[model samples]
Target: MDKNHPKSISLTLAFSLTALIFYLPANFFPFMSIELYGNRNTSTIWGGIVVLVESGSWPIALIVFLASIVIPFFKLAILFYLALTATNGKHLQLKLKLYNITEAIGRWSMLDIFLLAVLVAILKLGPWTTVEPQMGSLLFALVVIFTMVASASFDPNLLKENPNGKVS
Candidate 1:
């Protein structure tokens, strides 16, 4: 198969754009709702991080910020850049390195999802303490999965560079 095929590049771009569409709602809306003794509270991913920081759980806050926010946004930006440059035949080595970085850090971006799953499963104190995922969790998972697909569809071999760093 031709790794430099235009179809593959366009498909990667499409997925990356779709991922970005999902990202806004995912990060801004409530990810989970906690019910305790007839009281309920909803928190978005950012809100959770803020709560963690406010409560002095600096380590967890940092982890969430890096894993959920920084990594995913960086990946999306890199994916868009890669898609644009895939057919340009320039910066081959640099693009390859960026792709490798994206793949390496992809799994880490799912940390928030794992944490939510654990919380929903473990925080089951009947109706007194129930944790449940909301629309934002679904959107967030979709964003992560779509970004993964976008990265996987991209072919690093397509990046070609002349000695002058121009598409040849």
Candidate 2:
């Protein structure tokens, strides 16, 4: 890897770490709030999944859980790992494969965001009902964006570099 490659790797790791930082609040804080006839219902990502399971929508819940929670976390972890090990001169093929897979699956992480948008759009009623995204949605979106950027920023070539800064 060249000198600039190290900077690129560091940038990727930084973004991955930033996404991880955002991921916590994104899962715990309220993602959306619905107010109907003066009654308010607020839900975080996990809370929404539980509601879905309670309502016998386990499949949809699983989809949401995977897209929102599992996939994003996986992408971040993979990207962070790749960035950290880029110059270690080991597992080059495996690191490249992981990076490619992470990039390929990155779009699926936005599934939750699109679903929330559709829900908010479909459930918007007149004065009696309102659906608004909460802080968690914004934070979650950031996590997705940062992870995607981090994945994209990763240079597979780094995996070919030796620890002494020589390309294999």
- What C-alpha lDDT do the candidate models reach, one value each? 0.86, 0.87
Clashes of each: 1, 0
Candidate 1 regions exceeding 4 Å error are 1-4, 125-127, 160-168
Per-residue CA lDDT of candidate 2, range 127-167, in tens? 68899999999999999999888887887777775576565
The lDDT leader among the candidates is: 2
Task: Please tell me which predicted candidate would have the highest TM-score against the true structure.
Answer: 2
**Candidate 1 residue lDDT tens string, 1-168:** 243465778889999999999998999989999998888999998899999999999899999988888889999999999888776666678888998999899878788899988888778846579898999999999999999999889876677655766543
